[model samples]
Target: MSKGKEMEGEDEIEDLCRNDSKHGSKKRLVARVGGSSSGEPQDADYSVVASLSDELALILARVPRSEYWKFTFVNKRFFSLLKSGELYKIRKEIGVKECSVFMLASGETSWWAFDRQFRSCKKLPILPSDVCFQTGDKESVCAGTHLIVSGKEFEGVVIWRYEFAANKWFKGPNMINPRCLFASATCGTCAFVAGGIGMETNWKVLNSAEKYNPETKSWEPLPGMHRKRKLCSGFCMDNKFYVIGGTNEEGKGLTCAEVFDEKKNDWDLIPNMLKDSPVSTSQSPPLVAVVNNELYSLEASSNELKVYLKGSNSWKNLGPVPVKADVARGWGVAFKSLGDELLVIGASSNSYAGHGMTICTCFPKPQADELHWRSLDKGCTNQMSHFILNCSVMGA
Candidate 1:
């Protein structure tokens, strides 16, 4: 491209970016004072740096987020643009988004972020909650730019939020009623959590639910679920929050699932949602995800992937996942919706214990003759343990 086109692109980026920081002005003044007296070149010297051609711009605009790590190798301009998050801001301004994976593995101190293709990986800052919170079981969900993780702390149940834009972890804006083992889901900028074990005078399961807003940094109570439950999974489909397959207060596996209707401000319970799937005491919450408004689940006992027949409230098996889901009853696996694909990360059945985890994705077609799974070449995915403790996917 000619100088005119390059200048046009840079000008466009600056127009779209947030540049109101007073610190930026101070830094520019210092640079000008330290250099030429005329200072006419200050603007040129302080030009917002980024490098991409017309074709490359089209290619990188909305690809899998995992491919971002390669930008650091492209050139220093690209590296600076990414590290400063200006590119992400630019993409957001243009209304383009792709999903990125954030996961915590067994025996790891820090959570890691993987791009969609698993071609690049970056370690997030370590969560600073107390040891009790770190050691206990946790539930994670994403709303807007906040990644919220709830766990039991020494003080009691607490929340930790990871802010994507700042690249830092923040201690709540906690729940209105703090609890653990709850069902949670994200829709657009809001998150809904429901039905978990709460403690008072004794161990008791709860029917209460709450909605969290990242913008407000606070949780608001919602109408309770139909039945008190724990060890359930949650997801958003068709703009509704649904919780499924949990143990009731009497410690019995429940086939009923509940959907929260925001307009009605109430929950509609659906029975026999998981009647066909086995539910053992040792089994983990149903491994479920939603892609393009369709619900899918991983059957831990059979290592099978099943799609929910929403109209009939039944399930149809899509075939098996490439992991040992049955080994730990689906406890240590990461199952999440990655844009248009279903992503699973866990130890393969034949993989040696304590070895690397396998990452697989599939573009599921409901009732397709054969479900195809493709294993991508791993990047830094092998750096952590094979077991996944918590996982959340966020649009970036």
Candidate 2:
């Protein structure tokens, strides 16, 4: 019988877990036995179920990406126990944090907010078209009800606003500069966008930054990044915007790191990240977050998230990612913490050499040796491109 036909008779979904293996990783799924449809002897059925163990659950949890959601309907048991409660259980076991990712789908980008712990996610209709809108550099400020996204077609900027109470999207202000491949973030009720190459032949790398006031529905000039940049990563640390490594005009990586202080209305220098060999390398903009007054930079190259403690003035190497990740060569990477563990999303090349997004979440370990990376069951979607966390509802 085919695999589907064989599992059709199972009943009472138990637990499925992913087990670590010497060869790599495996899974084991366990379920309670139901009345046999085959009219077989009770003893024979008993033996089969006696063999079920936690190992089976672990292996089942590792269901291949192509088969993740399909396995949800394997039996009524799985739907109730694993599929519905899967996200929550995973979060509880490992201490999960809620986050989301915005991916370009159907010629536009949309955001998906997830309760990593519950595995329950809702799609936000606020879409990114030909607009220069994205999350701002402020760690505490997120794209709330108002956001604008830029598109490459005709320098068009589209603004999307979310009504949290009704859970819907409405129109907002348009951007003066319709930019693509830009970096942005939010701080103090203002959203700032910077560092995108204009469509002009000169392909101007922008150093100018613009701020959007949601209340006023207007754009104003903020202090610009010291370095002209495009396709760079920006984050808000300690209420200061940290502009890190990015490609130059000729598509060369930079080693410089700069910060913008909103209070002072000035840009200043921060520590520059360097590879072990001191060779200038463009480390993809880190998926960054602030916790316990420390700034953590998650780098794809190192597979490690380094934390900069403000008080100590040094980086604390916490632990490496849980699973092996092969993100695309040139695409940007983002890191955010859901609940307790850290989650990372990025784009990678498939066999066809097309870019696809990958999502992996890490669980906390008492010892650094305990860190593990587990790829989430990414349903049929373009490999994850870029994502952010919108905990606005949960926070309230």
Candidate 3:
């Protein structure tokens, strides 16, 4: 091509690039490609540089779990992506599954959350006035992102649900019967409450069971267990619900365990846990939790942590509860599974008012013989007045 024609073509391209800015084009050519009249390259559209989904996933994965609730307010797309399963998948792939520990104070109707990343505790919003009266020995369970609390009010059985997304508490459907000290566990999408003492007639022990469907905001009765149970412990594993160690109708400690198969709509009595472990049936039902799909129980009598092995149908002692000598007694202690660690929180059993509160974390490894428990919070202030009633771990 002739030199003049080549120069003319370059000038024309530069003119188009310069006009793009004045015309408010979403994209523009780089200065290196065609000199801009402004002497600076136009900003490239970030969406064109990378897909929106990929960019959003990257950003959301790095966001701290505690700050996640605020990010949802960015916009509708941000809110949807933050709550979607796709973002969770990205978090899993990036190893960013952050678990926060939620605890309810003993006498007060207040809730407290400890953020593992920040190593700090923050008071959560107070429960609604209707449900604020619920304190002491209430049955609470976490279903998906909602915290469901079931307790007895003056009128009858009251159910309250708190959603992290909304940071608000709302009333849920009332139970079929008013009861307390019930066995509660969440499986899949529903929360199941099994045997507990009824509010009517001398607080009669109940064998009745019911499942709460959050989507429908209703409760449906399930097949009652073979025997009435009170102070029973419930856990969901293998897509089934298991109720462990509780007192019978006659106020006798129960040794037999029962498993509810949802598909079969039947409860099968499993081997007795008392026979394998030193879990005392005299006390309230032992603390049971599922971590990494493995069942663990904290036997208050022995103050030892045991893991359930399905093949042997028994619990093997993982180790003793990791805490100071005084707190190791396991009195009023609560255990929660946070990611790969077990969080233990309670006051020292030896002290009536001086011990404050003890918080410990233990990481279990199959091959490691020494499962060291790290004390995250040694009570500096006396927490004897407040009880760490229940705890739950939520991943954001």
Candidate 4:
């Protein structure tokens, strides 16, 4: 390609961010983090380039995505690279991926993405999804670089995807089945969703499953599950997809879990796997995550952390987690895998007074009795400090 911009401006952008000036506008303060006016120290200067050669794209991809807004504000050429998703594509080709947390707080109009350390955050553009979709429950999963969120609208279920490359949300590419309260998990470049309630007027429970391919921007039907389940949870372990702990069509909770075998292209039922734990309507889907191929669960009824024993198809308690998952019944909490650590964000069991939240992580092991949980940073201001309605981790 031909060189497009002059690539000569010396004007540098502000350093990453500043806490929302307690009194000023949160949006303006956040915007200044990228503009040239902030008094913060100079960010590592990246000169604007005309054509994004693979070498330059590699360098840009290496930069944390939290800093990308600065480039877009200063150079149109750089903006096109981001808007066209070329830079994101280059990042994937070189095996460059960063894990960040995306959360939507209760009463918040838009979603906010925070860097892994919670050092900075950026507000996303308002999703144009209908008002009904906004008020209803939604399921979110990250496939490749896209954050796909599905929920109910006025007439039916709708899917909206936030493309990291383009930095925008687009509607459609809906599931071939289009359902809600499904079990979803991210595996490599694709996302697998299964066992949800259908959109029919009678609201039938479903056992069907499908895979979303971000590269093709379409959903491909997968073989159906053995049981019709809704409000379930899904995870990936040992290169296989597992669905666990959801109510069946009878409106009774299920203890049996199922694993999808890629080699066999079918699901194998693991009976009475969750028989040890109690299930009720008050509880959310199993608060579970896999770190280093080992499964962990934060029992929502109690504040305890437990490890799954794959050999026995059982769970072993790892002692109490720092956060209070019981108060919300596992709802409004974030339980996800952050690289090799298990990340849990919620009200503190110590003394949770308001909508504010606290974060903690642990490198879990099977037999570790007293697993040390280290508190991580919480976001600034009440805007982010509110109850978390939805949270998902994206590795892009």
Which lDDT tens digits does candidate 3 get at residues 1-396? 799987875675455445544755313222112233442423333323222233233445567767766655544444555554444444444445567667775565578766873266667787764543454356677765567777666566777777765667888667887688888887765788889888864788998898887656678999999889888889888889989888888777777889899899999998676567544445656677776677887777666777877877776777777533233344456777777777777654435652556677777664344468776643322353324666766665
**Which regions of candidate 1 fall more than 4 Å away from where they truly are?**
3-45, 48-93, 352-355
Better of 1 and 2 by TM-score: 1
RMSD of 1: 7.0
Tell me model 3's lDDT, rounded to 2 decimals.
Answer: 0.66
For each candidate, the alpha-carbon lDDT, in order, equals: 0.78, 0.48, 0.66, 0.80
What local lDDT does model 3 show for residue 122? Answer: 64
Residue 67, candidate 4: C-alpha displacement in angstroms: 2.1
Give the per-residue lDDT of model 1 (tens digit) for 340-385: 9999989876575625688899999887755889998887876678
| Model 2 per-residue lDDT tens digits across residues 1-396 | 687755742322222222223223222112222233233433322233333233333334344222335644444433434534342233223222233333333223455544443244456665433433343321112443343444333333454554332345555555565455566665544577777676443678777777777556667777767778776666566677666666667677666667788789888865545332122334434456554334566655555666664554455677665422324322344465453556666543232442455667765443354456677766634443333222221211
Tens-place lDDT per residue, model 4, 247-366, is: 999989999999998889999999998888999966899988999999998898888999989898888999998777888788877889998888988887777462456788888989
Best by lDDT: 4
lDDT ranking, best first: 4, 1, 3, 2
What TM-score do all the candidates reach, one by one? 0.81, 0.55, 0.72, 0.84
lDDT of 1 at 227: 94
Q: Which wins on TM-score, candidate 1 or candidate 4?
A: 4
For model 2 the TM-score comes to 0.55
Per-candidate clash tally: 2, 44, 0, 0
Rate residue 103 of model 3 by lDDT: 76
Off by over 4 Å in 3: 1-62, 69-98, 107-109, 116-120, 130-136, 200-202, 277-282, 323-331, 348-354, 365-370, 377-386
Model 3: ten consecutive residues of lowest lDDT:
26-35
